[model samples]
Structure formats: C-alpha cells, structure tokens
Target: MVTLKHDSHEHELNLTEVDAYMVGKGKCGVCEMQINEASSIYKCLREDCPNNSLSLFFFLHKSCAELPKQITHPHHPQHSLVLGREYNQEIVKLTRGSLPHLTACKLCSRQIDEQMWNYFCKACSYEFLLPTNAYLHIFTFSLCIRCAIMEPAIHHEGHKHHRLTLLRRQLSLICDACGITKENDFCYSCLPCQFWIHSSCAASPATIKLRFHQDDTLHLIYSVPHMYRSFTRHCQICKNEVLKDKWAYFCEDSGYFVHITCARTLLAYGENEIKHEAEEEEEDYAQPHPDLLQFPLPSTDSLVANLLAYHQLKNPSTITNPIAEEPVIQHWSHEHHPLVLSEKSTFKGDADSDDDENDDILICNGCTTPILNQHKYYQCIRCNYFLHISCANHLPIKFPAGKCLADPDHSLNLDKLEIKLGRNLSIAFCHSCHLPTNGFGYRCNSCSKLTDIICCLLPDKIKHDSHKHALVQHFNHPSFKMYQNICTACLAPVLDGFDYRCETCIDVQIHQHCAMLYPKSITHRFDSHTISLLYPPIYYKGIKYCEICELQVNPEAWLYWCRHCDQCFHPNCIRAWHNMKLGDKIFNGGIHRHKLTLVAIDKDRYPQRIHKSLACNQGHDNGSSLDVYLECAGCFFIL
Candidate 1:
C-alpha cells in the first residue's frame, strides 16, 4: 500500500522515485489531456498498475492487466474491484461528476468544476473551469464547494507519506499571504535521467511570458528549489510582502519567482522613445530572457507623456520676457492710516534714540514687524521696506519627509544666494509655501535673501489644519502665523489660504482645502459599514462605517466609504465605477490584493468608543492610551 504525506510542509519525498520513470499511453482521467498515444512516442513498461490506490496511477506496459485486483473502495466498504484497466476505468467513468474532489492547474491557475459541461474534462466527467487549470492537479486535491460534496479524501502522488485535506472543502485553496483562495494544482517530481509522470498525469504548456518581463520570456521547469519547493509570502513582481506560492511566475534564466496573479504587464503597445542629449545609448547586445526582472511602466498615455515631457523639459531656455517691474515705494497706506514713505535711516522719535543713524531702520514693509540687527535683513530703497532675512523664506514641512514637491518656478538655487546685502538680483520664492516673488526680500547680500518683491507680503492669519471654525483670512495681527502654531489636520503652517477658525480656539483649523479628495466615492471593507453618495441618495439603513477600509463615517457626506468586502469602490477612486449591491463580486482583476475581510471592528476603527486595547506589536505601558497611538503618529497628528 502507498502511504501519503501530502499534508506535511516538508518535502520528504525522495528524489529517486519522483523522476526518470514513465508509463504506457493513457488519457488523463482528470483533464483528458492526451499523452504517449502516438506510435512514434516511446513507452516504459513499469510495474505499477493503472488502477493502483496511489494518488496517480500508471502502467509501464500491460503487465497489470493480467493480475487480479484486491482493492475495495475505502469510503464505500462494499465496492471491490480488480486491478485491471477495465475495473478502474469503469469506476472512474461511473463516478466522474459524482467525485466531489478536484484540483486546479498550477500553470494557468484554473479551478475544478463538475456542473459546467463546457469546462468539464471530456475524458472523465471531472469539470474544470480552465483546461490548463485542471492539468496542474497532477496530484489529487478536493474540488470546490460545488464538487467536494462527495469525495472522501484529497491525495497527492510524489509525497506518499502524508495526506492533504482541503480546508472547508472549498475547491479554491486560500493563499497564506493576502489570503486570496484559488487553485494551481500540478505536482511534479524531477528525478534523475528521465522525468516521471503518472499515465493519468496531463501535460501543461511548458513556457509562459509575463507582461513585466516581456523582454525576457521564461519557460516552465522544475529544476529550481525556490520555484516549487515551498510556498512564499512576498509578491515576486512588486517585491511587496503579500501573496501565495503555488502558482508563481517563473523566470527561466535563474528561475527567480513571482506569484502569477500579482505580476502585471509592463509592455507598451506602440513604439517607445528614450530621452537623448547629444548622444544616445547603444542597444543592449545581450540576449534578453522573457522571465527576467520587468518593471511595469504606468499606463500607455502616462508612459508616452512622461517620456516626451522628460526630454522636452530636460533643458529649459531662459525666459525671453522679463518679470513685471517692482513698484517704487511712494504712497501706499498702512491700513487706513496715512503712512509716508521715507529714507532707509528714517524713523519717528526713535531715530534719535538709536545711536547708529547711518543704517538703523528696523521697520519691515511686511507686517510692520520690528527686526533686531541679529535677525538679518534686506532694505528696499524707495519705501524703506526692510525685512528680517529668516522671515523671508519658509517651506511647508510634512512629517516623515517627501509628500509635497517644490514648485519648479518657486524653488530657488541656494548656491546663487549671496549673504551680505545689495539689489543686484531680481526674484526669489517664499520660504513657507515656495511660491515665487521678486524685488523686495530682506536683502541678504551674503545669502541674497529678502531682496525679492513677494517677500513684501507675508500674511498673518492662515490655515492648514482642520480645527479652525471660520476660514481665517489675513488678519491685521502682526504676531500671527508664528512657530508652535499649525493647522489642525495636516499640522503644516497655514500659508496664504482661508481657514476655519474661532477666536477662542485658534489652535484648531483645517486649511489645505485640496487635501480632501472626492469624499463622495469610498470603498470600505465591512458589510455593516456603508459608503454612499450624499447628493441625490440619502441615508443607508444600519451601516455606519465601511467594512473593508474600516473608516467610521457619516452617511450624508459628498462621497462616503461604502461598507463591502469583495469589490466595493469609490466612484472617483476608480474610473467609470459602476454601482453594485453591497455584496457584488467583480470580474475585473483590480484591487485583488486586498483581503478585505468584513468585521464590525478593525484596527482602523479601534475601541469603537475610546476604550483602550493592548498593542499587538508593542505591549501597553501603564495607562497607555491606545487612541493616542492607534493610527500612525504622522497622519494621526493632523487630525
């Protein structure tokens, strides 16, 4: 009797038995793929019979046909049969669709089925959605929910010590990573000189070329250990930590691997161009393999535009027309008050109080803030518009670095800046927002800072956070917009923008209006949570939050995180998104990576009511507030 060892994670099957053996011609009883039938093909007359109880049966020649079989169906207890071809073939044909178990093709990633005639294996009544999918089940595995109603046990051939049993008896198997359950069945053994195959074993196409590695296509082979020995958790295509192992995209060169479902195509349908300067790079002379590392380009249009723009913008010609001229300081009123333009040294009675009359004008045109000598400065001649050099430049700092980009027009070349003082240069950008300005900056001849015009207008009250009640406009308060102050949501300094604020609660205000993307479109993970459109459609019944993304939300927003697990999505997030019921499943392969399990509570919405829960990774400190560190400290700080 052949013992089975399919369930064990270890590969205990010996190398000698798995490879270099062959059997006589026979149709694959499962997928019906023809093998050894041609007269020209060689046949091996081995000792194993076609009807052996082993997961896969074989016959070297017809030696087993003469022997009497002593096998009885284990599950049936009464159905006994001889070891010849007639008895096994009759039993196999009679129980085709009745056999509740099936497996998938390891190569094409298809599933087994019995109900669909078109997909059913014609040779035996074994139904399978993908013909190639059926071939991989070289070792027997249980069929899906539809087929598992009848089979007693699932089996494998190479590993004869352990038995593999399906979880929940689903024809589709769950991948450990990302948790997607599907099928990829072939069980192969590469012995020494010749490869072994059960007469019932079907053939799968030996080569596949994925989109990413279109340049280097690959052929399927069992030579590499990492390719087939064990399951993997990381996505081979993206190098991200999420996916299954059975059905992998194999690189033919060294056999580097990837999960088939996660790998995406990176080929352009049309001719692609590369940016060139005075010369172009020579074409590579080495042969490109189909299964080599392939980086997928963005969509076709994006790739073209990116290539075109990259080349075009490589060298920008200097602007022909000069910027608008700076106005000479003459008669601009400070508020409603009649403020008069004066020389650099002029001040009220304070002029006499200062001993240094030659260069002691400490007044600033922006906010009229007084600056000390240590603050550093630039002085406009006509209006006596002096500025604190440090106050002239600022940047919108995001936590963890690199969320926003510096506007090309606004960012200045620090190497070009002079430190001392003078007006030889013309323009500069704002330090806080990096917007452009020219003429009256706090003139740093050393760093050439405040000699720009736009530095003449830094507003006081602004908003970048969400807590501000009324949209705070430029306030007359000169001391506003200082350090240790930021918008409530993003926590960035409120620059030139209207902010929601209250007089008593200036600390809280949300600016950065663009921060909120289309709120009307939301895809959540929970069935109990409902994402919805606020315009024409009103409130949903009991759903309060999204099921998948797990965001607690209001039902009547512009767009909301809809509660669903399978294929729910926000209209704006996806182009041409269709309205589907809560439990709708999508055939389009987008968002397949998300496990999207549904539950009332998740990490996204912990403590439903602010009660503390212990941290999974980092244990709790005494009275450690879970709410404080629930979300990542960076984004959470904004709210």
Candidate 2:
C-alpha cells in the first residue's frame, strides 16, 4: 500500500486516487463486509489496500459514506484534493517488486479512496496503473493500526509554561487513560512536536481541545441554563453507545463539540493541538453555540440488525432455574417439634406474585422447608428453625431448663423437674450442655447439653471439635438444679448457663466444671484421667495446698480446683505446679524463708543445764492467730 512517513512534521493528505492490484476478492477495506455486496459498499481507490478492508479507514466500525471527502497532505503540493477511482493496470506491471509511480491528486489526498492510488516515480520515470483492479494500492495517508491509535497530547513546552502537539497521531503510545499501564488507548503528542491524541482524549472536550488549535477549530463554547453538555456525534471520542447526559462539547468549525471526539479520532481530523494544559482542562472555553440543533435519525441498518437479535431471546424468568431454599421457621405437629407452635404470618414476594401470595407458606418444624404435608403442624416462633412431629419426636426437644443444662457437655430439661425454690432460689439447667443452667432455657433431648433460650434459637445440632460427638440438648427433664457449689464434674464455678449433663451407654461420665474455661487437653500426658474440675468453694476448706498455685488457697474465693489431683489451686498456676512435680525443686526457698531440710537434731549437743532462755517461759499457745509473731512460744503473742 502507498504509505506516509511516521513524521509529524509532514502533514497527511488524504490522497484521492491510486493504482492497486486485484489479487482476489475479500472483505471491504472500509466496512469489513465481503465485496460481493459491492453494490451497497463503496470502495477506496488507493493501491496497496487489502481489498477495501477496515485498516484503510483507521478501523472505523462505521459507514464509509459518512467520511469527509476533503483533506490536505503535508508532503504534496496539492491544495484541493478530490475523491476518485485509481489508475489502470498498464503501468502497474512495470513497478512490480518496486515502489509504485504515482502523481499527487489534483484535489487533497485525504479525499481519495483508500484502496486505490495514482503515483509517480522520479528514479524509474515510470507510472503504474491497475484501474480495473480496485482493491490493491491503498491511500498514501492510510496507516496500519500499529501506528494509528496514538493521539495528539501536550505537555509544558520549551517555555515551561506552554504546551504544543500535532493534532494527528504518529504511532502507538503509553498513558494511564484508565490507570492501566501495559496498553491503553490514550491521547498523547508525538515526542518532538508532540501532536497526538487518543480516541478517548478526542472525546473529552475540555481535555480534547487545545488553546493553540482553538482559534482554528472552535470559535466559542459555553453553557446556557442547565445546558452544560451536548452529545453531538461529531465531537464524541468514545466508541460506547451510551450518550453523555450532562457535559457536551461545542465546536464552531463543525458547529458542535458533541462530534469533537469523532472529529479528533477522524484520521483526517482538521485541527491542531491545544496550547495550554490548564486551559485545555478548563470547561468554560467558549459560550454555548446559540444555534444548537438536535437531530433525530431514523434507525439505520446496523441498529435494526442488533435490535432484532435482542428481542428473539426468551425472558429469563420464564425459564427453569435451580432454586436454593433457605431455612425458615418450621414446626412438626408432634413431639418431634416439642417447642413448635402453630402461628400465622406474612411474607414478602416478588412483583409478579398476587397480594394473597404475600401470606406465609407452611414450613417444616425442623429443616424449615415448605411443608404441604400436614394440615396441622408446630412452628418454633423464635429461630424459625423447626421440625415436624415425626422429625421433632425423632429429634426430641428439651422441656424445663435446669442446672444440668448449664454443663457444656450435658443437656437438661428443667420443666420435667418440679420447681423446688422460688424463682431466685432455684437454678435451672440449660438443655444444651446439661450443666445446671441458671435462668430460663430449653434443652435438646439428646447430648445432655444445656442451652439458653436465646442460644436454643441457633440451628439444631451445634458441633465443637473439642467434643467427640456432635452435641444436642437433653430433653428428659425440664428444670433440674442439681448442684450449686461446683459444676458437678469439673468442680469449677457454676456460672450463668451450663449443662448438668450425662451421656448414655450403660456407662457414663459427668463432672461439675467451671464457667471460666481454658482449653483442656482431653488427653493429658499427666494421667489416664481426662483433666477434671473440683469446685474450689468446696475444695478450699480452711487452708488447702493448691497443686496449681502452690500457695495455700483461700477458703472463700473462687479458684480452679482439679479433681484429677483433688486440689484447689489458682487457675493460672496449673502449669507452674505441673513443672515442679518433684519435691526437691521447691520454688519458695527456705533460705530467707528458711529452706527446711529434715536434719537430725542433737538435743544432747545443747547443754542440759543451760536453761537460760528456758528460764524465760517457753511454751506453745494454740489460741492466738500469730504467725511467727512470737518465736518464743512463751510470749505467744498474748498481748
């Protein structure tokens, strides 16, 4: 194809005619449609063009009929180029394997057909012509995409306060148009003269127009009441179909900035680069062009084709799609849903549903799936997670809540148990872990675990990796307050809600434990016994040596008492005491604190007659609360 130099210094002329070889039939260089439809598609007469394909028009996806026909070429002397067909074949064969010989068009080269060319070669003194072959020689100004998309952009110029750019692009470029770096179509100027712009930059008017080119391209632009933007096809740069809502570009040359983007991206764009970046960034350049015309176009060939396709597809709602049902309030008519109660409610529905469809549907008491199965069913009002009697009976919910439910391991049904003390006096266990749960609660029938009424609202079958079996609340007794001093098994504090629980198997293990829990290794290197708790309140009587804290535990305060070793100790000191299992390694030294060793005492070594201090009454007095206050028992802190 006849091509132009990459230089921005040389202006491009859309040459009118050229010689081209008709190698074969192919898609139109301009429309991308096959040439058999030539009656409908116009052909560019430039030589070197690959059958009137898209590249000749800078890959414009629009119609060739709309393209401007007048243009100017920098290298050629032609001032008025007119559009026309190309050379005949007689001169083409002589230039094979060599550049074609052509003359500059009588009119501007920009107005020439892109697929044909008219040329001249001074060296060979030859002229090539392939007239009937309409698809070969492309226009001299036509550029390949590798060099087409770069845009006219400006930066501070030599004056440091100015900017300049060639209105035309020279080649591919780099910029953060969308903030993406690898490759993005953007506006930029050629490096030296810097005349460049992107399809996007060409679309954005304030960013698009340069002050330097304003005089040549725009007379004035401004907004009239509420009319800040204008969506004119001639000024728009972006290829997206959506029209701008508020902002609009105005140009005096074409009469509108709406086509500004279109004008700039146009290969033969007639304007130059804007001179000031700040001015280019400003929107108040020119006042509204008083003659604003809104043109209404009848649908065209492309629009009709796309619209027809869209209407042919089936609506999504009418099609079959998988439905995922979420859990909701459900109930069984029987014991299965022990807590399920029947109730009526409303529901939210999509627009298509009738007003009556807003009413609630029957749901299962357990899984909560819609249940058309039974006429009468129970529903859990709280969690919305309910089950049918068959399932609920199979699952069994706890009755009364009591201390047993408070245990983490065991569940309880306190309602079955008779209320012993008044509300404050009786400790009801939760149905979850079965430790006697305080306050009101419901328990799962199995697992002997206690659960608070609020906690019960959780989905059935809570699982803990720490527990071997997935736990459920015990449903046997409604309210049972078994122990108060300690959690029966662990002997830890019996806090608010715990389960006084038991596991079934002809054999079972239950231990009262503390509410303040730290993770316990179910398997301990210390013993075959899983570490168990001893309520410190009961274990620390008078003064007891704490296996953990090692200090004598106070008889009153709450502490972690271990049943494994059967000692009350500070919870924090368990590991410390464990570290000192050997009696030889006593932490508190008796040196100043008197390190006591069992040494043989020789009473004979003391003078039998020496009763000097013995003269001072030396005796033991058991009634005083003195600790070393009087080393001589004779005084025994009597005062």
lDDT for 221 (candidate 2): 28
Which sections of candidate 2 miss by over 4 Å?
Answer: 1-72, 77-125, 129-164, 167-169, 175-187, 190-196, 199-343, 346-365, 368-377, 380-385, 388-639
Candidate 2 per-residue lDDT, tens place, 322-432, comes to 212223322223223335333332222343443211113333422222333223344554334333333332222443332343444544442222223321222344434
- The RMSD of every model to the true structure, in order and in angstroms, is 25.0, 32.2
lDDT of 2 at 30: 35
**Residue 118 alpha-carbon offset, candidate 1, angstroms:** 15
The stretch of ten residues in a row with the least summed lDDT in candidate 2 is 577-586
TM for every model, in the order presented, reads 0.22, 0.22
lDDT of each residue in 1-639, candidate 1, tens digit only: 222221111221211122211211232232222222221221222335333332233222121111222443332234332221111222234456354233342123244433211112222333334334532212232222212122333444323454433222223434322234444332222333122222112122233333332333434332234423332223334444333323344555533444433432211111111122112222421323222211122111122122223323432431211212223222222222323222233332343342211112344443223333333344554434453332222211111111112222233321212112121111244343333332223333233333222222222232222221223333222245455444443334565533345465544444422222222332222234535433211233233433323443332222333335323332222211111001111121232222221111122324442334333223423342211222222222100
Q: Whole-model Cα lDDT per candidate?
A: 0.29, 0.30
Q: Which model scores highest in lDDT? A: 2
